[model samples]
Target: MEKVLFKIAKQWIAGDTVDDALIAAKSAYSLRRHAIINKLGEYHTSKKQIKVVLEEYQKIVNSFRKWKIRGAISIKPTQIGLSISQKECNRNFEKIIQKARNAHVFVWLDMESSEHTDETIEIYHTFFSKYERLGIALQANLKRTDNDLNDLIGMGAKIRLVKGAYREKANIAFKTKKDVDNNFIKLMKILFKKGNEFAIASHDTKIIQKAQSLSKKYPRKFEFQFLKGIREEFKSDLVKKKFVVSEYIPYGVNWLPYSIRRIKERKRNILLLGSSLIQSHRV
Candidate 1:
């Protein structure tokens, strides 16, 4: 049953190995779409587990250089033991960052829930001066993101702007979709004015259209980013319009939990899984 569910989940996950992720990324590259590869796992408790995760990322960096793949890597803070100790997490991050820097591949620090925001930012700041290829993601839905963006912009940081995914309290996040969208645009405009480079990571047509319109006015280098398998047609359309685009591809044995969280965040994903199961049964 797990294997069956995994088959349905593959619409979102690339596969269970680094090789699977590379294959998916290469396919995207052929279509002029870049990728952000993430190994699926987070909130590990033990140092041993964290070390294993670090080694997997090291292998991924090596593969990126070996294949000359046009993409970067994204990692969650907890996956590397940020919850265990900030200092330990920093040590783990440095190892991966050094490998990425040596291979000339970019590393993106993925923002988790609101709780880890400050520490994640601190970690990013610690290495920002040392590695120009490192970037961090920001959750636009957070009430504090505007100030965070301002601070990052002052440092000329590259950011990947995303709508907050993890569930958070009403006091800390914008509850409605409209508010999140408005804040995202607001932050995006600020980035265009002051940020060095950033990614507009959203699938909303209205948001993408707003960014497209803003491009005419602000005219900064930015790319559109979408999750794998969610909006292929729209992504291709963006490519046709000559906008840079990238797919966020995740793969690993931990896909089940990741897929569950995604489904909880967006209930429509349940329908997507149901459709996948039906199609597979027919096949």
Candidate 2:
């Protein structure tokens, strides 16, 4: 049933075209909700496909400026031709960062698998050294992330901290919910103290509880970010408390992979809520 729901969720996906992503972004912006639009395809099969992806991104960036919208667009390194070459990836990112500056927008680099963490950080650093409008993601579940935060802190980097999605080796990532939550809290303190621009990207009640308490400590520096279809109630509660709330707006017809990941991730979210994870993904 979960798989079936995911199969049907493809309709909720924005579309395969650049125009579809723009329409969805406009709607999200109109709701007084900021979006993080992303092209749905990943792991490009050829450089040509990657070029197509970059051109599409250029279109999205341009549309955001032309439409006078305020939001962000997130990109997976692999989707932007990362698998082919890191040098090329860095070049592509540099170009986009420049374009993003003209639009008065930010570009968030989405975290991928465990193997790509170091390279991703390096890519971010290389550009962040020159670009200020760009932000990067960090997953709390990784063992080395605490130290990674230390390095990023020295640079005063902006971050969106998530509980991580990619399945990783036991040595590199904790499998238990308790361990992951504990690590997330520990890292949360570091980000809060660094006084860096940050977002709490998780749906765990316990994590939200921690952020609620922590928000009193920072006043307005921290925000709670959740995916569009998950954890609907907390957004209002946080805004009422005067803490910022950001929703991740993922749009793309190739939602099959993202939907599948959401289903597997539901198992973890359900564990957090002490409820069943199943949901009908009616389109």
Candidate 3:
């Protein structure tokens, strides 16, 4: 059953090894799109577990240079050590950044639940000052994201704006697709006005079209990001038009949780993915 499930999940998941991720990245490169590789799992409480995760990230960063791929690594804070202690997480992230810096690789800090937002931003700020190759993901669903985006832009921080997959209370997050999409566009306008070197990470065609329209007015240094298997045709079209595109890749044995989160993220994700799956079959 597990094998059967993995076969279906592999549409989006790379596989259960770093080699699998590298293969996916190489393929993305062939299509003229960069890759952002992430290992699945988060909220780790044990130091031993954290160390293993940290070392694996270090290994991934080291491999990027040897593979000759133009891409970055996205990491969940808790997967490293945020669940254990902020100090430990910072130490581990610094170690990875040092290695990545030497290799000229970019590092992205993925935003988790609202509970870790403040600390993750703090960590991103600390390292970003010393290392310009670092970027952080921001959730557009949060009510506080507009303020957060403005503050980070003032700091000249590189950001990847995501539509936030974690569930949250109605008070802190926009609960409906209409509301979240509104907030996404609201924050996107701010990025075009004053932000640069950011990522417009979404699969919504309307949001993507809005970005294209805004780029014409502002001409900022930004790029579009989509998951590994989603929107392949659109991604190819964007690349052909000379727009920057990136494919987010994840690989690990812990695929079940991530797959569930995708379904729970938004109703639109389900429809979009369903359409993609059907289109894939037709091809």
Worst 10 residues of 2 by lDDT: 274-283
Q: Write the per-residue lDDT of candidate 2 for residues 211-276, one digit (tens) a residue.
A: 787766866466677775455457666766666666676666567777677657547653432221
The candidate 1 region of ten consecutive residues with least summed lDDT is 272-281
Q: What CA root-mean-square deviation does each model show from the true structure?
A: 2.8, 3.3, 1.5
lDDT score, candidate 2, position 88: 76
Residues 178-229, model 1: lDDT tens digits: 8988999999888877878999988777888988998888888899998877
User: Per-residue lDDT of 1-283 in model 3, one digit per residue for the tens?
Assistant: 7676565567889999888999999999988999999999998898888887788788888888788889799999999889889998998898999989998899999999999999999999899989999999999999999999999999999999999999999999999989999999999999999996899999999999999999999999999999988887889889987999999999988898887787688766667776778887998
Go through the candidates in order and give the clash count of each.
Answer: 0, 0, 0
lDDT of each: 0.87, 0.75, 0.90
Against the hidden true structure, what lDDT does model 3 obtain? 0.90
Which has the higher lDDT value, candidate number 2 or candidate number 3?
Answer: 3
Clash count in backbone of candidate 2: 0
| Model 1 misplacement above 4 A | 1-8, 267-283
Q: Which residue pairs collide, candidate 3?
A: none
- Pairs clashing in candidate 2? none
Q: Any idea what lDDT model 2 has?
A: 0.75
Off by over 4 Å in 3: 1-8
Best-fitting candidate, scored by TM-score: 3
Per-prediction TM-score, please? 0.92, 0.88, 0.96
